[model samples]
Target: MSQTIHINRVGLVALALSLCANAQSPQERSPIGAVLGTSTPVEELSTKASPAVVHIEVSSYRTSADDGDEIKNQTLTKRQGSGSGVIVDPDGYIITAFHVVKGARRIRVELDRRVRANSPAGELLNGKRRSSFEARIIGVSKEADVAVLKIEAQGLPTIAFSESNNLKQGQLVAALGSPEGLRNSLSLGVVSSVEQQIEPDDSLVYVQTDVALAAGSSGGPLVDIQGGMVGINVFSLTQRGREEGLGFAVPSPMVRFVYGQIRHYGFVPRPYFGVDVQGITPTLASALGLPTDSGVIVAGVGPGSLAQNEGLQAGDVLVSLDGMPLQNVPQLTWLLLHKHIGDRTRLEIQRKSSKIVLDASLISEPSDPEGSIATIDIEENLVAKLGIVGSARKHGTAGPSPTASGPGVLVVARLRESDTRAELAAGDVICSVNSVPITSVAQLRATIESFKPGDAIALQLERKGKLMYMAFEMD
Candidate 1:
């Protein structure tokens, strides 16, 4: 009886051990197994996503030296700049930073994880050494700073798309690209906010994030948690020309919009305005018979422009466009962007002591006039490019009064690299050349040619809406 009881006990122990083994076995493991149940980290998504990202290189040539002789030959020199790009389709269509391929003599696209070279990761570290796939420029919009390219290849991996609409503030975001020419570099951050407008023109709609975007990351995709692209890593707030932590992105919806327009129209659908405007102060609004603290004051309208065609004139306070209230420049930009060309909208205008309404159809601004004419209008490009600008008139407007103000000339616009922009402002009429009266571009050109590179000229001009004489030496 004792032997039988001991055997029974051993059998019971063996049964329990077998059950445990069956529960933990690969075949049984409750279907998931311990390893399979683990969550995947975000880096895995970046790894797969990086394969679709590409680096674009462009080369160009420019005149190196020019001789004063009209018929003399000039030497040409090579110039180069870099930006980021991504593969959007399996058909070899690539999207990249427009400024990158702009004016490029040649363009080349490099796949991210092409080959493992001399480095420990067996990957080619130097992008300049690796072979680049040739690409053709498809479309470009500089104001939006986006471009599209096409190459000859297939079976390329494409990133999944995510909507910025669903992206929440402070959600994690990742950036993958060859930032600063370092291949396969990854940086992580969070969505700082949504709908941030950082452009000086206030025309661009952006997704502001805390992602680290360097010079080379300009066109890289901003990835959300699901590895889907939320935005394209773009400009960052800068101080003294150096980057601050605040990074901005072109939202994915805008990216898709840009791509669609480029594919369909071969150019961006930029909105236009024919009316000159300035922010209205409370005092100014009251004087103009408008409600204080509302809308932009219409200073003038361009002849034969969309505004003039719609019967909009000077002294009309623009209160709104369409059904949307126009509180500021950005508000107007947003409203116009919602509609396309040929779309008609009603505008609320306060003229004299009565409110009026008018309908206008949006149209594209005409291309800049060709040829170099002295009286031709040049927009204030110097403020963004040269850090200084000089306009020929007050308010940057043209009229018969400006031509008759003074014959010498005028520095109507200036971007101050010095004390203040007002120190050398627009309305300042240019007079005298070495204490000589001058008029017209021809006289100004002749007087300037007579002096050497480092010569001084006595000048007289207006300042603070009052005429003051001052001298500026020429270089």
Candidate 2:
């Protein structure tokens, strides 16, 4: 009896062991267990995406006057800036942020040998140990913050892009870049917001993330877990010069659009509406005797423009475009950006209590008559005399203006002396000089030419959406 009882106990133990083994088998495991069972996907993704990443080194020369007693003596300063880029084509085409390579006299790209060697059309290894290649700028769009570059080498590893429109708010993403000059660094984060407007008047949309982007990370690829590029890491918020966790990126769709346009035309063709418009509030609507507040009012129409030819006059309220309601300048800019030259778009305008529908063809944006100021010699220009380099405030550009409708020249770079007390910054829009209303760079130049060095001038400026007066002395 004891032997039989022991045999039954052994059989029961064997049965329990068999059941446990079967439950834990790979085939018998639940789907959730299978998904959570491995870390290979993320690991493999990082390894796969790393090769196509390139480190961008840019060198720019800026001429600035020394703050010494020798005011007339100027110094040439060589500024070295670094950013990151991604290979997007096998023929060594790269896409990076325009700000990365902007004003750069020379650009060098450093690639991994392993990535180049693995390419299908890659040349066999010789004794050459070089990895850096001199890159040439293909095109740049400041408004979109995208730039294209090309190198002489072929058979480079490239990254694939995911469908940008399908990106979810909470999807997992990895930002690959040289943050703070650290090469090939990866930071993981989820998409905090899919669509974020960086500025009130700007129509450019960005992918907002908490991915810890730093100085050198600009123009780097923001990738997904599947090793697909989704966006280009662009900017992060800084408070008191300290980096913040809030980061933004140009979405892949915009990147691709700009890239294609630049590759084909050597520049993104900006479609021109040739009409200046402003959003109308309820009070402004009542004051203007308009029907509703939810429309844009045409402030000025360009002379001899298609808008003027189509009878779009000032004081006409734009109600809709192509069946979509036009509530603000941004909405109009956004629609215009997606359109191409020669494309016809219907506009519904409210003119004197009557709704008017006008068909207008988009034309290549006419170069600003004041755009020549960009090519003006910095040392000889009046703007430089004020210790700043600035551009005219236009309707579609980024900066602080009441919807970019204010008359001013936006300061882009400040080259002030240490002893100077001017509180002007890069984004400060100079509204006037010496109590004279300044509208364009040409006007600012004319005003500055009327004054001599050491003349104290009152500058009406807008900083961070606040209007303040500053006293600056001409150098």
Candidate 1 overall Cα lDDT vs. reference? 0.60
lDDT of 2 by residue, 446-474 (tens): 78778777889898887766778888676
Predictions in order: lDDT: 0.60, 0.71
Model 2 bad stretches (over 4 Å): 1-38, 61-78, 117-126, 278-299, 303-306, 314-317, 324-331, 351-353, 368-475
| Alpha carbon lDDT at 458, candidate 2 | 93
lDDT of 1 by residue, 329-419 (tens): 5557646655787877888888877888898777664321110111123232222221222333323332324333355455423332333
State candidate 2's TM-score.
0.64
Identify the candidate with maximal TM-score.
2
What is the Å distance of residue 268 in model 1 from its true position?
Answer: 1.5
